[model samples]
Target: MSGHSKWKNIMHKKEKSDAQRAKIFTKIGREIAVAVKEGGPDPASNSKLADLIAKAKSNNVPNENIERVIKKAAGGQEKSDYEGIIYEGYGPSGVAVIVETLTDNRNRTAGDLRHYFDKFGGNLGQNGCVSWMFQEKGVIVIEKAADVDEDKLMEDALEAGAVDVNSDDEVFEIFTEPNDLHNVRVALEAKKYNIISAEDERIPSNYVHLDNEDDIKHMNLLLEALEDDDDVQHVWHNWENEGEEN
Candidate 1:
């Protein structure tokens, strides 16, 4: 199971600032609260909550903070009016973009996204406009350490029912069917693999490359603006931006 590695691109684009980390925590906290409200606090019985806990840990969230959020949510102390919404659009040079958000105000989120797209030389489109270019899959990333054996890890991942394994210098990326994510992750954990992150992601089938410097700048600005929004949860796109020095 071999394919192009997207983890490198993801790692390069993620900002490591404290504010960015806090924003990540806030976003994950909202997701956890919603999961707890819908499926209960116990991750043992709540697979969604369990998955989210894994995600939070991978993001370096403190255990105490995760526990506090769960407890608050389970006790009904966390009241959120957030609703999940997806916005599809294009970045400069027709790069397909999809944004997932949890917002209390749809109008505000939509207007903000539209303005960002317009300002960055793109346009927000209707639902499904760019979604068709992507496929949903379970993506699990394991940090590559000195002790990690690439061949062994690949074998184990395949045995765990992963569909593909992609590797770079820093990490191993395992792809699995969406429904099998938790099971595959548990299997890997049982084998003593140190997971970096495990989550469902929309992967683009094809990538768009921009040769124009203006288009590249606009694309980067659009992505940054969307990611900075408090309401935005995840942003998926098909820009082949590896080695661009973000």
Candidate 2:
């Protein structure tokens, strides 16, 4: 919910950079396959499948491709034995970091993740080493307009059971507990409001502010290295931006 604009801005910048859209598609396809295998392909009866479909569409995944994936899952042609793993650690500048990954090869993924952390001046740690610094939350994004009534939006979201809300210059963001995400989203949809994006995220409880240029470079390298991992779905960290909400 906090710094909603910053989060949306970061995502917009990311979605436009498609050096390997295939990788993104593969990731989404994998998730879709997993969801279908676990709960069946009927989105109406499977909330996870429905969410994956929406995400795939937002990412411009083709309808034919989505259908093929659904068929593959329905026919049991795809293997989705992957397990979700979360690795926590501390990055440069004592920044708390959490990485969420889905992998079929746990050994390979774990080894690679540990190696990257060690090489990047970041150390992988025990379960609660850094996880205590983050809280899992549901985030819903809405694109901003030049003129919008913030109070009205806040009132609506609060009534819909959003736990907290934040607004940046270009977006209104709503946060909810993980279990409440779907309900709030359903409430919003009933009102004819379309969310630009919605996802489960780990927001850091606090932040570590960088001081020197060298520190910035070091941290960026660590983040980039972690992001390059194929198994990685999302990376969360506790780095502060002094620039504040825009």
Candidate 3:
């Protein structure tokens, strides 16, 4: 089973619930603000900002909201200086978990994250604890449009520096080296492909399957709590999907 994609599906299902859209907006807005602060408000001059803009649009973030965040960051309205922090931990059934956060106050965010881990069936760990189990990779998602030729698309991606490509019912997942993401994405765009999402992500080396009901419940809670935090940007984990078979 593909753990990351299955978990993404679960997250998408939950996004249908009330208030989830607001949460998504907030998360994407924070990303946009950070990108602008790091580079600039102009996507043309800032590759990172451009990628974030594409991501926000793929997630259905309103154009006005993205513009507002970029303008605010550029105008110094976002006064709080945030730093990126990664927290490693183990969820139920010893599933490796990594939480990425952008925080202005490290102490508070750490404390809250520790509390969530403790409240669930997990314990926070030191840096590099479980990160070794994952490798950084670029993931590009393209929707499976009508009349699209899968083999031809795969050939194009490979020729454009993509390392791997996988297709399912809904989308084609392309993998590339972290540094080659933008280049490969631009190449695909030149071919007039509809890019659904493109970003750097951690790919787990292995997955731990949770069959026990209690473990599944606790793991779900742990994921939910971590994702709910305002400082938390991304949560990577190695849990085998329940419905998807290897």
Candidate 4:
């Protein structure tokens, strides 16, 4: 998770931008709608919905908007049938790229993603082509503070069923099994830890370093292009930032 943290920091900065925030809200709204349809509007009765609510709140999504979307979805007013789609491919320098999208039209999303990969000098591959390099894990990031007790936090996370607790000067990355994410997060919340983000993520087993100037440039373009698509919810890749951690 060396370069990944920096990459996340970069994306977080982008999320602060006006355009990206609007896109984030739209994407998160679709997630809420789907969660409501799958489970129920009641977060207490629906664990998935509850986790999504927490995720939305972490992203600074307004409470009113979340309630409105849940109501609309529960009322059967949101007729757009969106489905989750995953596309696996390689970006510049053979960096494994996994693009997750929630879209009503599969063809449109596929075409748009294919175009972005092609335009950026990357070729989209068949499903599982690049995903084999990744693993599904529950990742929780907590911003490190001066007064925080690192050892106690690690012990707490481990006791909560976390597989690993990686701490640096910047943040504490707690890893857990995919199914244990919400439970571990809940435990940490109970302990009053400042969680920056908690969600399921694809952790790459090995990283691909992009050192060439052209490779880095094209890789950035590919990522930006993929992220700009409204259908694309999350973009996971193994591009290692060749620099020290923040």
After superposition, candidate 2 runs with Cα above 4 Å error? 4-9, 12-17, 146-148, 242-246
Off by over 4 Å in 1: 1-5, 17-19, 242-246
Local accuracy of candidate 2 as per-residue lDDT tens digits, 1-246:
347534843664365446668877888888888889889999889887877787788777899989899999889888658788999988766888898988999999889988887887778888889988888888877767544567877888889889888887667788988877777777876766657777777887777877767667766777777767789887888777522222
lDDT of 4 by residue, 15-38 (tens): 544466777888889999999999
lDDT of 4: 0.84
lDDT of 3 at 136: 91
Task: Return the top candidate by lDDT.
Answer: 1
Candidate 1, poorest ten consecutive residues by summed lDDT: 1-10
* Residue-wise C-alpha lDDT for candidate 1, range 1-246, written one tens digit per residue: 223447755675554334589888999999999999999999999988999999898778999999999999999898777899999998888999999999989999999999999999999999999999999999998888999898998898889899988887777899999998999999999989899789899999898878888888788788878888999999988888733633
Q: What is the C-alpha lDDT of each candidate?
A: 0.87, 0.78, 0.84, 0.84
Global lDDT of model 1: 0.87
C-alpha root-mean-square deviation, each candidate = 2.0, 3.1, 2.8, 2.7
lDDT score at residue 212, model 3, on the 0-100 scale: 78
TM-score of each: 0.93, 0.89, 0.92, 0.93
* Error in Å for residue 112 of model 2: 0.7
What's the CA RMSD of model 3 in angstroms? 2.8
**Model 3 bad stretches (over 4 Å):** 1-19, 242-246
True-vs-predicted CA distance for residue 44, candidate 3, Å: 1.3
98 in model 4: Cα distance from truth in Å? 0.3
Q: Give the C-alpha miss distance for residue 131 in model 1, angstroms.
A: 0.8
* Model 3 TM-score relative to the real fold: 0.92
The better-scoring model by TM-score among 2 and 4 is 4
